[model samples]
Target: MASGQKKKWVDKMVFRAALRRWAQAARASHRMELSELREHRTRARRLRAHLDKLIHVAEERLALPMIGNQAFPRPVDTDWAWRPELWCGPLPVPGMSSVASQSMLGDEATMFHDCAQSELTLRQVRNTREADLAAYGLRMDVFRFDGSYLSLAIDLPEEASRGLKRSHLIRIDTIVEMEKPLEIFARLNIKHGPNTEQIVRELPLHEADINVEFDLAYTKLNEKRVEKLWLDLIFEGPEMNQVVLRDLTFSRRKRAAL
Candidate 1:
């Protein structure tokens, strides 16, 4: 037998022996804490029931669409595409509404406010309807707003940091349903060097007005100085409103050179 092969076999045996000892120690600990484990199980069942009831209430009030298995759209010559909501499973912090601003919707999204008297809640709803063609959507409910400004900021994934250039066109597509007619704006922010550039566009009221494209060439984008990218959804007069964002996607493509 080779010396190296013998050493490998001895190492494997030692690992197995260590694992066995650990498992035996774990079993003994579990036996000693069996009563505490039983109490934990009982509490866990109650928590599960409460969570189920909460989900039921959300479905009743929100009436979200069913989850679907459909693909999102992309522009021709697409270099990058991202669907923020459907990128992962359900959000850990599903809903929050209060006077204090927070970022409970995971690391990728944040909500900010400067209102003295207002309430805001954001949650991910299951998309069951086929028309949505997406797995999830964000529902934002607001009331009694007296804020200077409020916005939902979504951090783009790391894929966006591929060194954007002036020749790239960034497109934002969204489906919005509001309880009342309200002015909403979408802002694209790009951080380059020590400066940040912003491009703002008001979302149209009609369903047909669902897309906006930002021409990087129009801005002073230092191609070599590109750092980060993000999007902001700014709401104006959002009092007593329920806004459902059925879908939001971003795509980038090269602009046609004249």
Candidate 2:
């Protein structure tokens, strides 16, 4: 064969070898892309399935007996966006009240962080409500040995808690240890969007369980919103005495929710 022809044939063989390697690389890349697409679709399908289950659970809870009644009150039904495990279910008996609650050091629910002020102990905890009693009724066991023992509850207002600058009422029920007759103070923590303030008032002059309810007709709210709130129960008297708080609950009326 002529030398020039032989050289041309060798060049053609090299070109064909390079073309085979490029084809193999292209096929591998295409397979990898297809596998990734499949994985993404699987993940999306799982997420959608989970969301469906959550929605179903929320709807079921809204159907429970007297879901929005006073004692067994229902959580605020916001728009269908995020759902918390705390909301969708037959609520574990409200051992405290319809909404937020607080107790002294040894009291029920959970002990407060500060110990320098008073020492509170949990005496008993009730999870169920009696037929003759109110909703989410709890018999919280609490006794104060060093300082004042205060238990508080804050109930949310309607209108999605919007345009409300302050709490509608401050309710206090206390069992105090009398050392020359003590005095207790109750404060309402109200927040409206960016503004937060404390509304404080002293308890009645007496012993035993003093049930107090404050009206919010005085506080002004203009295009306000309430997202969080609480109450502080303070006792003023001799530092050493024992006080007991039995039933602390939130409601529209003095009677318990059925």
Candidate 3:
């Protein structure tokens, strides 16, 4: 063999031997005595810290940019557009099982239910599809759901309600995939000084893309007293099913006067 090739092969064999030795030491760490274990732990922690940094950098450099990109379509006359933080980036806590009522997944999204025994899971997964614009997606799995009510509430940013008026129309677009047939409703709630206005629309699951619009002209909304806005996604008969929300977006535009 060439000298250069032999040197490379020797280096690889040495690295493999070192890795095996470290693995054996880690496997036997549990049997170590208290003082010895403490010493071993200190060294292991230092080694782990360096390894973690290397792994983190390697993953970030090699993987696609899937954490912060938020680009989606909007109406021609749209004044504002938004994509919730949960769908635009990774959450600090990504997944939860046996979720309780009023559990929050991130700063903007919350899970609510009335089940006596919780059998639900919520996870934020990377959107690998080429056509997907959002960086992340939310996946929900339900097994033997006995809840009387189930909903996922997302708090809209303050900008959504800023300079609000009665002539504006709010639109919601989403891409959802379900393992079986199910019913879902999207409700928009706007809180004013002392009252709240709500509008509900059923999602057409049969369609490839789901879209709904709420015309503020129809609601008795106090434009001057608008304080906050939010959305609730209610699900019916979600038992023994899996649902994936690939993307969700919001936009606002002025309604044409009659």
Candidate 4:
């Protein structure tokens, strides 16, 4: 072959080699950027752990309880305005996800989720107190969320509701305080099927978080209709009080031995 022809062939081979090298370099650059992004995500996860630890320490000192610990964290919905104090963490930058776990939903303060709802605003009446009781050493600070719609909901799980029947006795340990003497009426909503039926009963207003027994003899849990139930402790008259509902539990009306 002529020298000129040979030289042209060499040039073509060199150009192809250069193009391949450039393509490889581009791929390597993309991989490095991807790796860096992954590292950043890992670092953010560590930061979340650190922030949660700080919250736990602070709550221990102030006696504040968080919402959930081991349970799955709830995605932020209407909670952006006022999150539980313990959830204060580095603001999640856009394009990043925040990790959370169910921590302390059952404390003195109001809880606002389904796992352990202790809504501070779950008073039976919107702005009134029972007629026969006065505030009895119940202390709470309005230092937190002003839109205090934190009404507590007592969740009756499916299993519990299924086992429950009419005439079943329920033992409750609660603290009711009133500003004046009046009788407090308790309104309970037992959800049966797709319907919500209300049952109203009266309890004497005592100025203390007291223990009471709710005899289900008259409650008449419609076996065919009773799906689940929630109680609303209604303060009949005007007496500003905080009722510390400790627990609302049930005991089967055990059959007597023959």
Candidate 5:
């Protein structure tokens, strides 16, 4: 072998031996005397400090351009695009069970339901698929949903409504997987002065890439009074199903004037 390759192989073997020694020490730590245990603990803590830093850096580096990345295709003439916080990075609280109505997963996403008994779980998981653009995904498992209405709401950032106008078209793109056939609807709610304009579109689950567009021209949107906007993903007949949302993105573009 070349000198460089031989050196690397030697270093790898040394690393493996060191790790095995540490593992043996850990396994025998329970039987160690107090003095020896204290000494070992001190050394272990020092080693762990360096190992933790290494692991953190390695994980961040391995994630590459996925974490905190918001790059996605935008429609022609599009001026704004956004991916929710849940899909961009890890959440402080990643998973929840028996989620209550209006429970929020992150700063931007919330779950709502009227179920008498909460048999649901929501988790933010890493997306490892090669084609997944977002670093994270959301999984929802519903064992027995007894509610009449269920929806996961994502509040848009302020940028989405900034410089708002009536001639813009908003679009939603989602990568979703389901354990079984389920009907889902995308609802865009724009809250203006004392009024909320809503446009709902059923997702084409049959398609591989689900995309929906909402033309603001049809809504009675008071562009001047536009304050906040949010999107609601409503699920129909969601009982006993597992749904994974791999990625979701929103974009806005101006429509040609008549």
Candidate 6:
């Protein structure tokens, strides 16, 4: 046989000898060895259970349509869409996305009650019912209101920094359910450098008219100076009202130039 083959045979023989010695040692302590083997098997079972749970979690995560950590779903349009309730998460802050006795409006949103002697609570609710809009909605409960200027403000995405032109039309669609009939207004505010322009529209009483469009062409928008944009949903005679905002969405499209 070749020298290399002979050396490999010798190495295999040495490995077998070591295994035989180990087996003999284990057999010599048969009872203790059996207990150790049983313990190892139990540990393996526990590890498998943990692994199964991890796999389940991973599967659920994969089932979601989110591209990354974004909680909202993607819109069919190629432009931007925002769902505040879903964007935050399942359990949102009580005051902002959720309403509790002492909860206040959440971050990235604000409320003005300069001269109020009332209570305001906001909460985010999961929409389990079938809907094409969002998986979540906001509920705002107001009681004993006494403020001169009252408005709930929500900030838009930072992508607005890209710039907005007079040729674009901002559209807002929302589903509002109120305990009592009241007038609610939607205002779009655009800040450009040192100037701020606002377009206001009264929400129609007809449920079908819950959509509003703001043509930037009608406003003095310095396209290059555009900094940020926000929306304010104002309520009239909102005292002792339970307003449930089922869905809110914003989109932009080029206006058909005249």
- TM-score of predicted model 6? 0.65
Candidates 5 and 6 compared by TM-score, better number: 5
Q: Model 2, stretches more than 4 Å misplaced?
A: 1-120, 125-180, 205-209, 220-223, 252-258
TM-score computed on alpha carbons, candidate 1: 0.71
Clashes of 6: 11
The global Cα lDDT (0 to 1) of model 6 is: 0.69
Candidate 1 residue spans exceeding 4 A from truth = 1-70, 86-88
Residue 28 in model 1: shift from native, Å? 59
Query: lDDT: which is higher, 3 or 4?
Result: 3
Candidate 3: regions farther than 4 A off: 1-66
lDDT of 2 at 143: 35
Encode model 2's per-residue lDDT on 1-258: one tens digit a residue.
Answer: 899999999999998996786566556655667776577557658866987999998776444423223333212431111111112223443333211224432212333323343433333322232321222222323333443344433333343244332333434443333435566677766665687556677767563445665556565543346665555556554234444442344332222323
lDDT of 3 by residue, 162-189 (tens): 9889999999999998999999999999
Runs off by more than 4 Å, candidate 5:
1-65
By summed lDDT, the worst window of 10 consecutive residues in model 2 runs over 78-87
Locate the minimum summed-lDDT window of 10 residues in model 6: 95-104
What lDDT is reached at residue 190 by model 6? 93
Go through the candidates in order and give the C-alpha RMSD of each one to the true structure. 11.9, 20.5, 12.5, 19.9, 10.3, 11.0
User: Against the hidden true structure, what lDDT does model 2 obtain?
Assistant: 0.44
Model 1: pairs clashing at backbone N, Cα or C within 3 Å:
65-127, 65-128, 66-127, 66-128, 66-129, 67-127
191-231, model 5: which lDDT tens digit per residue? 99999999999999898789999999998898899999999
Assess every candidate by TM-score. Answer: 0.71, 0.39, 0.75, 0.36, 0.77, 0.65
> What is the lDDT, from 0 to 100, of the residue 160 in candidate 4?
46
> Which candidate's TM-score is highest?
5
Model 4 worst lDDT run, 10 consecutive residues: 94-103
lDDT of 4 by residue, 1-258 (tens): 799999999999998996796566556655667777577558658867988999988866444222221122222221111121112221122111111112123332222322122223332211113321211112221122323232333443455456556644443334444333545455556777777656665664444444344455565456687777555544333224334432233233432234
RMSD of candidate 3 to true structure, Å? 12.5
Mark the regions of model 6 whose C-alpha exceeds 4 Å error after superposition: 1-78, 85-88, 96-104
